[model samples]
Structure formats: structure tokens, C-alpha cells
Target: MQSTRQNSQQMDESDFYTNCRAVYLTMFKSSLENITSKEQLCTVLQQAGRNPSQKTLNKYWGPKTSKLNFDDFCEILRKEKPTGRSELMQAFREIDVNGDGFITHSELYKVLTSKGERMTREEVKAIISVADTNSDGKLDYKEFCKLFMSTTEVCQKRALERMEADNKMRRQQFGSHSEGFSKSSLSHTANPSLGTNQQAEMDVTPRKGEGKSSMRPSSARSRRASVSSTISMGASGGSKTGKLLMPKSVQDWHHTALKGCFFLEEDGEISSHQYRLDVPQTSTVFLTIKPMNLSQVEEKPSSWMSVDAMFFIVKDHEDLDDMRVVCFTELREKEKFGWKGELSSGVYYILPFTTGCRLKKKKKNIKEQAQLVCRGEGGKLALTKEFRAALSDIFEVIDLDGNGLLSLEEYNFFEQRTSGEKCDEEAWAVCKENFDTKKNELTRQGFMDLNLMEAIDRNGDPCDLWVTLESMGFNRALEMVEACPFILDAHSEECKLRLKAVNLKQSSKVLDTAICKSVMAKGEAKVMKGSESVTIYTYKNDFRITSVIANKSNQKVTIHVNSEQSKNCLSSRGISMFAVEVPPRSNVVCQHVLPINERQEWIYNCTESLVA
Candidate 1:
């Protein structure tokens, strides 16, 4: 078989070359001896359908302006010829008449038959069956290339060469053993402590109470140095104990706080958010208070001091949490806190007079909480003025009928255009039930009430932009979003609201219940609504029966399966035919399993009596 294939390939190549030489000779009309000058070579090339420039012809003729011989001309033509893949791609595109990224069977058949190739429909189907790896019943670019190039010796040789080069590269990267270099080997190269002698000794001798050593001496030395530095610093600072000193007035307190000193009161309101501190004698402090969790504060509180207005106290401490209370003028400013100016640790109490009315915290209702959780992380939902305005603009655009409402159809079109997929059914159903007050369509008010950003959350946690981007199949867009999160914010004032509205509409469309009936259903089964019971029959010739049962009742419905010719298919699978509960307003697929030759007549009975 191999020898026959090789001979066939050799014959094809020889035939190709023969056709090429015949065409060349016919176009030139003169023998190799006749062409002597650059002008003559240019004339012959131009006659052969290649308009060679004077400079290009000169390069071929050499610095002396000599003419090319017939052998050199043939070699140049061979080198200039397009590769098999390129030619195949061109042919594939030509055959793909509609340019829908695939060549249909009919398209291929028409193209082939028009070119004088005679073949039956079955023969064409057979060829496609071999090439269509994805089983889509069409020839994609890969399938078309494979079908044409697999038979060509040149393509096969090129493929083999690529495979060999890839393998060689893999071996070089992974090494011959394929185990890769150990962490110890990498650390040895990075650290200067691991000299050649120490590395050699470690390789020869295993450490005490160790089966194998993955850590090099250099890594151990580096770790010890770090530990010793930390210990020495602690020893030097720990000897001197400092006392808590209180500031005379709020102005003094503010000055000390600006110098990176914080004071925490025992009974004061402590939260992980921003607050306005209005000291009676000092300027109002607009700062964010970050309270350290117990696990983070290793050192015990040295002393607790009670001050009336505010105070500045210092101690020898490096840990941010050791100060017991830390405050930042801004969120970004918190990153600047470190053991820099003075080794500080202490808590100061402040009782500030109100400059104006304090901001009130509004209690959120359950519905609002659910929406907020969906929109932002950690229940922190604050829509910028620009973002809200953007949403309003989007809502106006989506209201195509201009009745201040978005119908289901309009919503679906918007979703299809934005996310490329329908919104999830369960999510849409929830939105309609909760946000869609009229239950007819999404009104502008209803749309605004929905947390569209949260609706795309797949994991039901806080809204994640990356997850949303990925779900929408915007992978490259997601990378850009990661690099610049503010891009979403920057563009939010324009299309953010529109994007969310589309998301909500998509969610609604995806959840709309539509049943899929068995394709094999003829007249054997009949669907009838009864006051107490519903009965369905399966065809006698049907070896398997599939039916989609939707529960329209307020409560769950259990389906009872019965068969006359065989054991209950549902019962055999350990499912209770009498107690198969279908959730309210949800659809369930009921299928009967039987042997290929076993044609069973079955009946499905559902009634109020079967409700569970």
C-alpha cells in the first residue's frame, strides 16, 4: 500500500512539472539559446504573464547585465510558485460561494459538477463525512485544507517538517528528563551564598532527618538573614516602653494625625468605611478608618488612654495593626502607611462637636439589598452621577415603541446584539416576577429598578466584570478591562446603562418556556387537558418515547409512568413514576428507555392526585 501510494505521488509531481514546462515553453516561443540580453529576458517574462521590473530583471541578469539561461529561469519559476496550502485556500474560498466560513455539500457538488467532475450525491456525502471532523455536515477551512492537502506529497512533507521542529523546541524547553529544574537549582543560581563547593557537598550528602532536600543552602542563608534582621530590630525597639500622650485641642490632634498618628476610642463607632471627624478645636477630618482584625494584631495593646477632644501618642511599633487604630485621609493614602517617621503605637479618643448635621445611613429594604448585592461587591453599591445618567439614556434608546416600555421582542433583539447569547431563563423569570411590576413588559421604571450589572453574575455572588466579559465571549475585551478597570467607568456614562438594559432583556428572553416535543411524534400521542387528569400515549412502533411536560400549576406535579409491554422505564431507572415532581412553571423531559428492537406502548398519567 505504501509503495503504491509513493508511486502515485511521484506520478502526480511529474505530471505537474510536465504541465508547468509545457506552459512555459508555449509562452516563451523561443529556445533557451535564443534569450541572451536583459531586455530579451524581460520580454519573455512579460509575455509569460509576469511584468518583471527593469531593476528585478537587472538583478537576475547580474552586475554585467548578462541574460539568464533556461535552467536558471525554470529554477526561479519553481521558487516563485505559490505553496499548496495557499492554492488550496484560494480554491476553498471560491467553492464557498456564500462566504459563510464553510462550503456546504450542495455548493461543493455544484462547483465540482460545473468543472466536469461527475459524482453522485452519496459519493460527495461520503467525501464530506471523512473530512467533517466537527460533524456539522459542511467543509470548514481546516477540513477543506486537510481533504485537499493530505493527498499531496509537498503538503505532507511540510507538515512533517513542522511537527519535527515543534518536537525539537519542546525537548529543548522541557529538558531530556522532562522533570524540569527543581526550585533548589533555581535558588542556587539566584543567591550568591551558594558557592560551587556548598552546592557540590549538598548534592552528595542529604541533610539530617530529611529523606530528600529540595532547598539549597543559599535559600536557607537568605531566610536566616531576613529572620535575624527582623529579630534585631524587634530587640532594639522592645526595650524602650513609651507612654500615651494626649493632645490639648482638636487643632493639635489634627496636626499630629497629619503626621501619621491615629487614636481609637473604646466606645466610639468603628467601621471599615469613610467618616467625617469634626473636632471642636481642630479642622474637620475627612478620613477612612481601617480597623485591624484580631488575627492581624499580634502585639497586645500597651495602654489605653481616654482623651476628651483628641490626642497624639507614640510608641516603638512597626506593625500597622499595633497602633490599634489607623486612619487614612483617602483610600489611596492608606497605601503610604508604613514604619517610616516614628515607631508609633497607641489609641486616642476624640469627642468632636458637630459642625453640621451628620450624614444619615438609610436602612435598605430586602428588595433593595438583593439589587445592591447584585450590582456591587461587599454590598458597596454607589452609582456615580455619570453612570446613572448613562443608564437613563440607554433606557430611552431601548424603548423603541416610545411608550416608555420595552416589549419582549425588542428586549430579545437588544440582547442578541449585545451579548451574542440569550439571557439565562431562570434569571429572566426572576426579573419579570420581581422587577417587571406589570408582568406584561419591561417599563422604563422597571428597567431602572433592575440591577442589570448583577443580572450577569453567573455565580450569584457579587457582580464580577471579568465574569460578565467572559460570558459575553469578549476575551480580548476582558484583558483590556483588566488592564483598565476605569475604562468601564469612563465609558459608563454613555453605554453602561444600555448594556445593562440589554442584559436584563436577554435574561427575560432566555427564561421564556418553550417545549421541545419528540421529532418522532406522529399521531400515536395526544395531549388533552383534563379537570383532574392528563393522559398521553406513545406510538407502538416507537422504541423510545420522549415528551416535555410543563407544570402550569401553582404547586409541583408528579408524573406517573405506565407501560403495557415492558417494566416501567422510569421506575427501572430508580425514579419514582408516581412521585416525579416537576417544579411549578418549569419544564421536565420524560424519556422512556428500551432496547433498540423492543417497541413498547406506554402511557404517561398526570393528575392533581399525583401532586407532591
Candidate 2:
């Protein structure tokens, strides 16, 4: 029996070798890349039911831990899509601890801790709590998977919030000192009737700790005491060492005080906000004030201050840029901060500020006028200079060979370094074959070459492009598209249309858009509501005027254009601007020219009447 088993194993090994050679020849039609091992290749053959010896497999695939050939197997599976989501789920369940439909928080913690997570008990508990959305004492498997899948989003939001809070605190502390000078100067200006001599005397001298009263002179100099206003030397008037008189209003203000500052527009009035300052001067002078909280309807005190007015004494022209000045709109509480006598409120920005130098507005054609000058779509993006500088700083990291455009090989190396995943050389080679070989180098044009819309446009023919980015995951590629100039900040009709095409073409799996195109209608569509009108258009000439579609259950009809048309085109049977005046159920179709891609495909779009 032992001899027979040995013979059977030998026979299986021979069969596997023959099958592998055949598959390689049929696919690459060339010799495989340099190889010192055959283990993974043998495993594939065995998995395909062609038997092979363990020794033979090891020779082809190297050590099991190498993962080089395993990556190739995965690459083959991806191209074939041999198994779907259900199979992947089953594989995932093999490692899952909980028997419940999903993985659990405790199970994850156990696995990660066993894997050597460098965290403390409390830290682990905190992280788990955040993931356990159901708050049923533990995280369900679905929740656990969600947490793992969106790790990038989770970490980004938390980091952003923490940085914003830290910046806010720093600005408040620093601004207090710098803002004091301006507040004092503004106060003097507001009450200018007090005579010039008094103003001159006020500017007499600067002393240490000039703002905070705690740093004043000692009481031993009482003999030199003069008028009460001369009490700058010490707590009491001069060095008299006498008890100081205090007003009830001042005491009330201090007791209810929430220490902070606010900014106001140059032409804005602070009276509506309600609080008043008796001594709104530089430093630590007491302010006799009243609540501006809406609940306190009194008219005497205004609550806010202008940023310029408060900081005029200390600020220069440069400080005006990239500065965020906030005003304390609410009073402080033991546990939470809120407005005095109001339901709930806190500090907010008084001035709209950016984090870096602002850009001067660009003059453009009248037809290309942007709606908003700053931070608006198609408008000059905020801090363009800063963004460019940052990209310059990190460019070297991505440009491994410093040749500028990242070659497929160089990009694969980058992916492994940044994503902890290795590329499947076979799959990558398959994808590379689809690119224009004449280009030779992977330039921006080469990347855009993969864009289905671009492919259709260049060929002047419409067919679904099915190229894939092997090694680079769908999410990573999506990020690159988002940052690209053609996609980011695009708002015009043409740009928006192109953006949609890019999005549809870059989808992870092949999409079914034939249905979307078949349903399109041709010609201009007119819609009318009580007082509104709208226009509808289709991408291609194939669409016929179909009966008006209206009043379907809650799912309002939206216009669809041929996947190839500019993304933002109007469509027949869709709610474009022309339908604004058309009433739903009042069916009407008009014949007119409609734009189409090179393929002559279009989809129906509803008019505003559908919305009505």
C-alpha cells in the first residue's frame, strides 16, 4: 500500500506540471518571470484538481509565508470573479469568534490583543465603546466590520476635531493678551468727551503686568497716595492701604462672568446681543455688564465687540490675514458652556478666516463668473498657495525614481509601501496591455487613457470600457480621481457632466448602463407648474418622446442621460429647468435638438414640472 501511494503522488505531480505549462502558454504565450520556487503554482494546479506533490508545490511557490504566488492566485480570482460576496463572507466567518450573525467587539478585542495590540485595558475599552454603536454592552459583528472597513474616515474625523479644538484654545489665550491693547484704545475713543489731557495722562507709562491687577505695587507706599484714579501704584488709591469701594453691578458682573471675547463686523452693532462693558479697556479691567442672552429681553447692554475694535491697539495689517477671532457668545458653566439664561450656546467665529495666506481674486470672462469668491464651487479655492506648497513638499515621496509621472511598477511599489498589500504581477500585466503601448511611459495622459469616457471620446465610439487598476484598490483610485483637477471643484455644466462620466467609469465593478441609455427621450421637453417652468434634454438622437411620467410613489422621477453625454445635460422626460412651470400629470413633450456622445446614446430627463 505504501508503494502504491508513492506511485499515485508521483503521477499527480506529473499531471500538475503539464497543466501549469499549458495554462502559462495559453495566457502569456511567453516564459514566466524568473522563478526559483514552484509551490504556489503547484497549489493552483492541485486546487484545480490536477494533483501535485508538496515538494513540487514548494519548488514553484517558495515558502508559504512568501505570499508572492498567493498574490498571483488572488489576481487570477479577481479577474475571473470566480466567487462573489457570499463566498467572501463565508471566508470571513472562518476567523470570526461569535456565532451570532456578525462579529462582536469582545471577539475583535480578543483577536487583536492576542495578536499583540499595544494598548492598555482602559484604552481598549474606550476604542471598543466607540465601535459598539448599538451600545448593547458589546459590538455586533456587522459593527465591527464597519469599523474596520471605514478606518480611514474614522481616524480622519477624530484627528480633525482634535486639531480644531487645540487651535481654538491656543487662539483664545494668545488673543486675550494681544487684544487688550485694542480694547483699551477703543474705549478711550468712544468716550472722547473726557478731554485731551486725561487721554494723554492715560498713555503716561507702561509698567510690568500692566493689564492684570495682581502685579501692582505694595501697600507700604501709602504716604505717596493721591487721587483714587492714581491707584495704578497699588490695589488701593496709591499706597493708602485702605479698603476699596466696590459697586454692586460690578460684583454681579464678576459673579456671572464668562471670560472671553467676540468679534463684530465694522458696521455691525453689538447692542442687540445685550451685554455691556463698564470698563472695556486693555488688560484686566472689570466690566460692569448685563446679559445679552435672548431670554433676558432688556435693551441696555450690547453683547459683542468688533474684532478690529478689540485688537486695534495691538494688531498690524498682517494679523488681519489667516486670523480667526472668536467671541464668547455664551456664559461658562461647571460642566458645559452656554449662554447666560439661554437654552444652549457657545463661542463662534467673529471673522471668516483661512488657515493660510488668502488669494487675490482672478478676473475671468463674464460667462464664467463664479457665484462665491472664496471657498465656493468653481471659485478660487481658499489657500491655493498653501495647498500647492504642501503638494510640493510631499511630491518627492511619491516620485520614487524622480521621473515625474509614476510608472505602473513604481506605483505598485508605492501601493505596497503605503497600503500593506502586494501587487499581482499577472493581473497588472493584463491591465497594462489595455493602455496605448506607444505612450511607453505612464503619464497623466496615460492615466486619463483608462477613463472610459475619454476612451469613447478618443475613439469617437461608445462602448463600455472594462479596464481595472490591479494592486491599487478601488478606494485608493477614487481618492486620486477626487484630487485631480478635472474632478475637484468642477461646477460648470460641462465639467459636472464630465465628472459624472469619470465616476461611472471608475466604478469597482462593470456597471449596467444600457438600461439608463435605452430609457432616454429625444428633443427639448417643456414642463409647467403653477408659476414655474423647466427644460428637459436627452444625450442622443435615439430617444423618442415618451408619455409624461409623474406621481409615482414617493420616488420622484429624475432625469438620466446617456452615460457618455456631458454629466450635467438636461434630458427629455427629466426635470430640467424648462419643467419648472409645468404641473405634474399635465403631460406635454416637445421636439428639439439634444446633445449626444459619439455613440449617439441618450437618456430621458424629467422637467421641473415633475418636481412640482
Candidate 3:
């Protein structure tokens, strides 16, 4: 068989551009004037047996150069044709079986052994390791071409060496046999007719396409030559040593071979039942958990469908482990979906079906719904009698000073003692809003009217809090209070203290407006007393407290700032110092920061009380 080097040399000598130029000119009818646009040029190229995408055309005839003359067109063809690589790509595509643009171990193994070659698993792995640069255990077009080109070079060199060796051996044997026959006396002793017949046999040569003559040697040398011929035939017939390596199974190719399709049923009932869709042997299937009501059924699918849940099912391949079913929840509209995790072999009622989407209208008021759900069919008395009595006892203890009405200071003291930390001022504010009466204090009756304990019990249930929050327009504070009743008391106490310290009346029409502006602007507000002002900035997870203390008296004042929260508040400079000195007629600013969960009560006192 001819070596790859020889074949390449032949191809080089065959005037490739001459043939391409002729084809191009023929497509344009011997003129290039009418080929004005890139689309026109692509058509001409395709008609001439060249396949190119729009991107390929743009690389040569770019957007800047709209028109191409004959000379430039021919020049591009010569420079960008990729003759050898194109042939290699064609062969690769043929072996790629599934046409996934990647050559998998199975496809490679099948193609290599199709011509009677056997490959082991380790050998296949070695071949893949060489070209699988991404470590994905598959060869893309570029990698496959690189592997094939290298193998071809090696095969050519080996074939050339074998041919040269065979030629040398033939020469040595011919000379030795000729010398021995010339010196032998057997020819003289034999009959002249017999000698003539032997000479005639020696002079006759085998015809083309016929087997080697019977006169050839039947020794080790001849057997080696036969084996070399077989190897050459295998190489010439599109077989490569690298192709014999096959991966263990199809799983190795799944990362590239697997594809998914998602489907949603309109007005489908949500149920806790297993649904099955027949999957293709080598494909994956994904189903979106969207349950649409009749009102939402528009002529065109809206992008706002609640895709809060989804699941995937993969067909079994080779091993049972390849078969997977996974479900995911807490998804949002237009959020990219993926498998949550591997699920066991059982029926799962995913999302909309179990949530009864079709049976109910789209929720318009989430907070109201959350409240109703939390109340349940058991009504407001969801708590047991013992739990209710325990709650009443707790409330009585918080009503400090024996006033029947719980003042903000009393509530704050109660929370500080119970939690063993400083009060969460934000939690206190929320409690005040929900349970405080017209007097700006939480009365026993007002506290019970809120049903704080029952709300907490309902919020702790296994219902989806994310969906509830979404319906409620994401009222995080309300959600937090409902989930934890202790926050209500804390917030209420904080509110009472703020109003009492500021001496603001609850009956004032401007009270709600003033509090709303400060709280709504940044979820926090600053309270000033005497010559000292404190602003607390509340975040989702932490709080920043900024304090300014001014000394109006004609003497220096020493201010002490201490955090009652569990987490020690750090100053802006990262120090734990709480005491700072202020000069006469001057002010001092001190800032403290801590995480929300670590917060307790905070106290600020001067060496001498300042007059308001």
C-alpha cells in the first residue's frame, strides 16, 4: 500500500486550485460581475460542491467588502479551501454516527473494528486521553482531526520502513540463490530437457492481480511479509490504530450525547401521582411544573407563567445508574432550570399538580392568603389550652410596673432578659405595629387579638414560604413576625420606647406618616435625645449604629456606649472601645456594627445626664 506521505505528495502535484478555479468560473458562467452579495457568492460556492456556512463566507468576504471581483475571489479560494483538512473532516463526520459534532468512544471503537480490528478498554482510554483535552472523554472535530493526522504520519513512516526492509531482503536472497545455482553441479547431472523446463519456470513472472508464484520462500521471512501486507491493507482501508480503543460504555459519551425537551400541560390537575413520558433510547426529557388557570390561557404563551418547579427523567443506558429522575423546587419565572438531585424509584407529585393550580385562581393577595392558610380550619384557637395559658403568663410577666398596659421600656426589658442579649429594635417595631393599642402600648387584650402564637405555629408548617412571600409582594418583616412571635413583642417594645423617648402621641395624625417616611426610606430611622442623636441602619443580616454626642455644657463629657446584643458590636475601626470623650462645645461621633441575629439591647449613658 502507498504511504500517506506518498498520497499527500500526489495530491500536492494534482493542481488543486486549477480545478477549484474552473469550478468557480463555471458556476458564475465564466463571469463574476453578477455575483455582488455574500449570499450570491455562497450560492456559487455551494453549487461548486463546497459547503460553507454564512460565518465562513463572512471571514473571507466580510461586511466591509460587499462585492468581490474575480481575482480576489480566486485568491480567497486558494488560501481558505483547506483541501486535506476538509477530506479529514468528511471522514470524521462519517464515523461520528450520531452527528453530535463529537466522536465518542463507542463510535470510534465501532469504526476501527468494523474492518476486523480488536481493541481493549484500556487502549481506548489511552487514545481518548491523548486528544480529549477538555477531559470530557470525547473528541470534538478538531481533536479527532489532530489524532488522525498524527496516526497517519506514524503509519506512513512504518509502511516505508517495512517496504525498504522487504526490498533489501529480496535483493540479498536473489543474489545468494543466483550464486548457489551458478556453482552447482546438479544442473549438469540432470537431463537437458529438465534443466530447460526449470529455466523456463524461473524466467516466467506472475501476472498483475495474481497470487505470488509457488517458487517464493515458505519461511519466517515470507510470513513476516504477509503480516506487513495485512497491516498496510488495514491502514489504506481507513483503519487507524487509535480507532480500536472503545470506552467502557455509552455513559462516557452522555455529557455530549444527552439532550432534553421540556413540556407543560395547560389546565392540568395537580396531583401526587407519577406521570410517565416515553423517552428515546439515548435522550433525556425535562418537564416544567407550570399549572395554568383558564384566565391565564392566552392565545400566545405568556412569559409570566409560574415555573416554580420542574423535574427531569433520563432513559436507562447500559447500567441502571444511568436512569435518573430528579425534581427541583423554589424556581422563579424565567429562571434557568436544572435537575435538583437524584430521586428514588417512586411516584413524585411535583409542584402545580400537588398545589392544585388548576382548581384555584391566580392569587391576588398573598398576605391575606398566608393569614388564612396559617389560621387553618381550626380557626384562631389553633394553639392548645396549655400553650395559650403559657402565652398569657408570658404576656403578664412582660407587663412590667403592674400597669396592665405594656410600655416600650417594659417590653424591651422583657426581651433583653429572655433572649440574654440586646433587643432587635426592628423586631420591636414590627410587634408594636401589630399589637400596640391607641395608647402606643400593647394591652393584654390587644396582644391576644393579634393571635401571635397561633401565627407562629402556622408559619412553621411545611407549606412553601417562598410562594407565600411572593403572593404577599415580599413583605419580609411581616413574614418574619408570623414565623417568629417573639419578634412581635420585641418590635412592639422598640416602638413604644421610640415614641415615649421622642414624646410623640399615638393619636397624632402625623405619627404614622413620620414613622413611615423614615422606616420606608431605608428600613431604619435615627432617634435624637438631648445633645446626642443615634441612627440605626438595619440590613437583612446586620445592623450599623451611628451615634453623635454633642457637649453643650462648658465641660468635657465622657460617653459610654455598650451593646446588649449577643454579638459584640465593633467600631468602624474594628475596635471594641465603648467609652469616648467629648470636649466642651464640641461633638464626638461613634459607630458600632453587628449582625442582626447577634443583636440584643444597646445602652448609651453620659457621665452626667444632659438636659433635653
Candidate with top TM-score is 1
Local accuracy of candidate 3 as per-residue lDDT tens digits, 587-607 = 333332322222243222212
The model with the greatest lDDT is 3
Give the alpha-carbon lDDT of every model. Answer: 0.33, 0.28, 0.35
For residues 1-612, write the lDDT of model 1, one tens digit per residue.
988886665455434333333333443432223346777776555433344645566656753333444434544455554346776678778777778779877788787656654666787777778777788767787666766555444533543344335434533442332234343333211111100110000000001122243333221211011100000011111222221222234233222121111211111111111111222231223222121211214565211111111111112112322322222111111111111112122222221111000111112233322222233577545443433443454454345444567666556544553344666666667768877546477776676556443534334443443233322222321211111000000011111111111122110101111112221123133332221112232322222233434333233333433222233233112222112334444444333232322133233332212211
Q: How many clashes in candidate 2? A: 63
Which runs of model 2 end up more than 4 angstroms from their true locations? 1-523, 529-531, 543-612
Give the range of the ten consecutive residues with the poorest summed lDDT in model 2.
198-207
Candidate 3: which stretches are off by over 4 Å?
Answer: 1-88, 91-127, 133-138, 180-612
Comparing 2 with 3 on TM-score, the higher-scoring candidate is 3
Writing each residue's lDDT as its tens digit, candidate 2 over 1-612 gives 988886565455334332333333222212222122454455444333233445544543432223332224332323332223455356447656556666556665666566543455676788777866777765555555555546534543454344335434543443344334432332211111101010000000001111223221221111111111000011111222222223334332323221111211111101111111222222222212221121124653222210111100101112322222222211211112121111112221111111010111112334431111124365423323332233332233333334556555544544443344555767556556765433344544344444433434544322211112211111111111101100011111111111111111111101101111111222222322211112232222121122222221111122211111123332321212121111222211221222223123334333222210
Better of 1 and 3 by lDDT: 3
User: Candidate 3: worst 10 consecutive residues by lDDT?
Assistant: 194-203
User: Model 1: which residue pairs collide?
Assistant: 247-311, 263-348, 423-506, 425-511
